[model samples]
Every structure is written in C-alpha cells, then in structure tokens.
Target: MKKSLLTLGAILSLAVISCKKSESGNKSVIKTDSTATIVTDTDGKIDSVSQSSSTVDVNGKKYEKTDFVYKATDGTLVKVVFKNDPKESTVAITSNKKTFTLPKAETKGDETIYKKDDMTARVKGDSLHLEQGDNIIELKRTKI
Candidate 1:
C-alpha cells in the first residue's frame, strides 16, 4: 500500500509540474505579444517603428531592414510607418520599385489589417502576416 501511495504521489507531482510549465509557456507568449507597443519619444514623435525579423532575398543576397522601409525578394518595396495613432498607421507595398502610398490601416481588435486589391497585410503581436492570393508570408519581430 505504501508503494502504491508513493507512486500516486509521484504521478500527481509530475502532473502539477507539467501544468505549471505549460501555463508559464502560455504566459510568455502573451507577454511577448503585448510588449511590442508603439514607441514614442517625449516630443510625441514615433521613435522607432516595430518591425518583424522577416528577410527577403533579392537576387542571390538576403536583405533585412531595420528601418520603416525595405525591398522584398521580388523587388517589391514595402514600407511601414507609424502615424501616432494606432489606427492611422500605414503599410505600403508596391512592385516594380514604384513609389506609392497606401491608405491608413484599419484596426480590428489588436491587429491592423491593410487590404489593397488582392493583397492583405495584417500587423499584430509583433508579427506581420502578408497574404496575396495563395501566397502567405509571416514575419516575426526582430529582437533588440
């Protein structure tokens, strides 16, 4: 009986530990998402825009930008700029290296979705989700 009790106690302890680990993992994910808030300076200007760690290869070289603008693998120019207001932020994606501005993004819940024609750009939780027809791209935030 004592051996059975010991075995049961060990199982319960293992279960409790596993539960705690899973809960901590979930909390960490939540924290990582929430920490990507818009950074602003004392003068009310956007200090730096949040960006993902996604990289695109142009030609045979991989390129990643830390700024608000960059060029994708297919030579599409992409820009993400802050507008002080979360709802007013903009995401512009143009091909052929042409310069064009897109309308401000529309906020839905915690995400900003930018839709133009068949393209969709969703910015949320330190990640960028880009979808064009059947092609989907996901970019995670760059760690400091």
Candidate 2:
C-alpha cells in the first residue's frame, strides 16, 4: 500500500511540473503592407527614416515600424520614415547630397498634405504629388 501511494504521488508531482507556465510570457507580432505609401513634410522637424522591417527595442521589449521611399524627378531617391507613438510623427527626405527633415502632415479626406516654403507634397492612395510654383510632379508606386 505504501509503495503504491508513493508511485501515485510521484506521478502527480511530474504532471504538475510538466504543466508549468513559460518564462517572460511576452510575445510580439509584426505586420507590413507593401502597398501602402507614407508621405510627410520637409521642415527640419523629423530627422531619420525607419525601414519597413525595422525593430525598436525599449527596455528589452520589441516594437515594429515601417517606411516608404519615392523617386524624385531629379532621379534622386527620397526615403520617408514613420513613427508610431504618442508624440508627433516626423519625416526626413534624402536626395543626393541634400536632406530635408519634416513634421507629420495633416490629413484632408483621403489625402495627406505637407508644405514647407513654396513646396507642397500630397500623398493620395499609392500616388505622391508634389507641387511647387508652376510645376507639379507625380510619383507612383512601383513593385521591385
């Protein structure tokens, strides 16, 4: 009877140990939409651009972010980074040897508009439109 009780106790102990919870209990998930384009202004308020699969670590916790890039009429590449936080969003445009940092833009209906000096950038859907004085440039998304 004693041997049988000891065996039962050991089995119960093993079962409890096997069912222990995992450590940390923290999980992270990242999702990206390649079809979405982000646009912002060029006013020196924003500095850096974030990558599409960029990971930010805060106190050992990971967060996900995204960015967008456009081609200017001068053939220079323009990169726009996005930040997800309570503070204002920033935008930085890099073309050749010139870089313009801008603030988060205001939304009007389905369009986002950013303006600085005499230039205005409008992002609508997957297209970006830039208007300066009498000239207007339109940029569309291209898959690579």
The sequence of per-residue lDDT tens digits that candidate 2 reaches over residues 5-106 is 999999999999899786846466455565733434356453343335465788766554556777666665666554544455555555566766555569
Model 1 lDDT tens row, 24-75: 5654455534445465645787655445434456676655433454444554
- Best of the candidates, lDDT: 2
Candidate 1: clashing pairs of residues: none
Best by TM-score: 2
lDDT of 1: 0.58
Segments of candidate 1 deviating more than 4 angstroms: 1-79, 84-89, 93-101
lDDT, model 1, position 47: 52
